[model samples]
Target: MTASYPHTRLRRTRATAWSRALHRETTLTPADLIWPLFVTEGVQVEQPVAALPGVSRWSVDLIVDRAREAVELGIPVLALFPNTQPDRRSEDGAEARNPDNLMCRAIRAVRDALGDRIGLLTDVALDPYTSHGQDGLIDDAGYVLNDETVEALVGQSLNQAAAGADIIAPSDMMDGRIGAIRAALENTGHSNVQIMSYAAKYASAFYGPFRDAVGSRGLLKGDKKTYQMDPGNTEEALREVAMDLAEGADSVMVKPGLPYLDIVRRVKETFAVPVFAYQVSGEYAMIEHAVAAGAADRDAMVLETLLAFKRAGCSGVLTYHAAHAARLLHG
Candidate 1:
């Protein structure tokens, strides 16, 4: 079988680990990770998210400590999601606008504890604060209203910014919210704050574990098809990314990362902006289950899956595996 092709041996570089490392095309590191932390009420409590094996919902006091650990690991950012008490959940998600709310308080606490040691990203969606869990104000007909939701998102973004949030991430997918939030941030003198819009969030079944983390699954009355994009279409994702960029999004995200890596690649290719991906709750859970079942190696799977994002043209990724992956990379 070894004929004239024997002259071109590809095994030379693959013979040594050092040689392979020197020739690696893409490198994964702690700097590329963004840890998603769930914020709840109380002082030092850490509640495990049942659906997501290694993840937990920590109170503000404990979250400050976690943020410090993330900084020590060279992880640059932490995205905050709140688990509001049932009593605080309202139809209009008015609690989201309160400057002293759980999310805002956590943002301030982390900022004060670590200063600018790490970037603080606060979620601007209302599903965590709403009883109906629609991510926006629901009409009598059960439809998620786009314009009205944008107005509330503006208020939510302003509140987070007032609490010292470094970035206002609009995950609600409501039309025109990015422009409105950008304008609000400017008017409120937060001109330097960044906007990372969840521009191509598809309505996917992979969001179940995420809903459980925010305590929104059981409260959700119906599907969010009206707002989040349909998974069947890819051109629509390009349009959404373009619109968000035009509206002043500093970076754009394609959610449920593994399933939509194609969308990530396409958006990055067409728009040439900073494209981020969310290795969402269910994706984490699936890998965890396989590892637990002895079907896969945890360390190998984590690094491979993360490198997949890099290969697919992601600038950064929001992942629950950030700390673990960072430790592996640093090792």
Candidate 2:
């Protein structure tokens, strides 16, 4: 007689912890995380970002301490964003090229303290340095000029490289900036520096908390629709990735990771390159609030959410929960 039940039972493997572990399709670990830290000025100060909950804007001195902690946690990299003071903001974002500026200084401090133990990544954008909060120079018509921005980004990338930045992530989305930065790196004897372009960065509402953390919240006069990708588009992401790869990006990133996992999956499958995602500040706050409200278990939710990115084929994630999640994994 024919069997009443199916021959294959998927739940059999999931019935035990060991079985589940052996059959797991995706694995997440501390090495898969890249911590994004906010850099501010001064010493002995760590300002908690209200919107981002556990996140903080640390001073250059404090950043080195955090870098030591990150090394202990096994987190492989740190991406830095500066909260440039108002007095330093400029129309042309000239401060970005200053090797002694906040971002550059933080990079040097962390590298000097940690040496080659952890990779240092820096943002090659003008938003944090611009008086008007635009990512690049704009004309009287309020239109962002592309070529001028690319030139500035090249200078920014060189400055970061000089300060020991291992990766130059161009989040500004300016046209041809990746190729420009890549060439500048090679020509200036920084051939070892990597360009991890924000190839598919979307102009999403999910970045509000990040703006606050970086001190660009109230300063932005208008939206970044001119450069950043539209959230409504998908295929455009692949094209953007292709262009950036052609221009010499060592890796490409998809922003606001959870909401855009489909894009992450597509890009990973299409290019087969090292794909990364940014679990932006808003996503971090949402999960934290849910846990605070008793709507989710903190440890379970964080690990599961992180594993989902791995299942979606992301090689690594730039997340706010790096250290906390690393502790859970190690435990």
Candidate 3:
């Protein structure tokens, strides 16, 4: 007689922890994480962001200590964003090109301390430095100018590369900015500096905490919908990714990660390139709030969420929970 039951039982492999590990199709490791650090002006200063509980903006000196911690935790890269002082910010955001600016100082400090031990991914955008809090130069009507913005981004990319940044990540979402930055880098003898384009950043409500952390919340005049992608368009995201790739992005990123996993999976399947996702501030804040409310286990949730990124075909993730998740993975 033939077998009455199915020959293969999928649950059999998941019955034991060891079997589950052995059958795991995706893996999350400390090296796969990129920790985003916010830098402020001053010495030995650590200012907590109220909106993003457990997250703080550290001064350049303190940022080096965090870099050390990240290195010890086995995190591969650090993404730096600066809280430009009000006095320094201008309509044109000229401080962004200042070699002595906070971002550059923090980049140099980390590179001085860690050398090539870790990769530095510096954000190439103007919102942090712009008094008007737009990612690029704007008109009197507040419309973000694409070509002019791309020119500023190129200058910012060259500035960061000169400061020892390994990756110039343009999160500005300006059309043709990636190509402009890439050509500038090559011509300026930074041929090895990788361009990680924020290819599919959508205009979402999830970026509130980030704006607060960067000190741009109060300065922002209107929404960023004029430049950022629409949340309702998946096909548009694919087209954006294609344009960025053709323009010379070494890797591409999808912002506001968890809600955009479908986009991540689609981009990965379509491009088969190094794809990264940013688990944005709102996502991090929600997880923390849940843990505080006793509705979820922090350790379990952090690991599970990060592993989900890996499973969703993300080559890596830029997360605020990177260090904590790394500790759990290490344990």
Candidate 3 per-residue lDDT over residues 1-331, each given as its tens digit: 6569878878999999999999999999999999999999999899999999999999999999999999999999999999999999999999999999999999999999989999999999999999999999999999999999889888888999999999999999999998899999999999999999999999999999999999999999998998899999999999999999999999999998999999999999999999999999999999999989999998988989999999999999999999999898899
lDDT preference between candidates 2 and 3, better one: 3
Candidates ranked by TM-score: 1, 3, 2
Q: Give the TM-score of candidate 1.
A: 0.98
RMSD of each: 0.9, 1.3, 1.5
Q: Lowest-lDDT window of 10 residues in candidate 1?
A: 1-10
The digit string of per-residue lDDT tens for model 2 on 185-221 reads 9999999999899999999989999999888889988
TM-score of every model? 0.98, 0.98, 0.98
Error of 3 at 213 (Å): 0.3
Q: How many residue pairs clash in each candidate?
A: 0, 0, 0
For each candidate, what is the lDDT? 0.93, 0.94, 0.95
Summarize candidate 1's per-residue lDDT along 85-146 as a digit string, tens digits.
99999999999999899998999998888889899998998899999999999899989989
lDDT of predicted model 3: 0.95
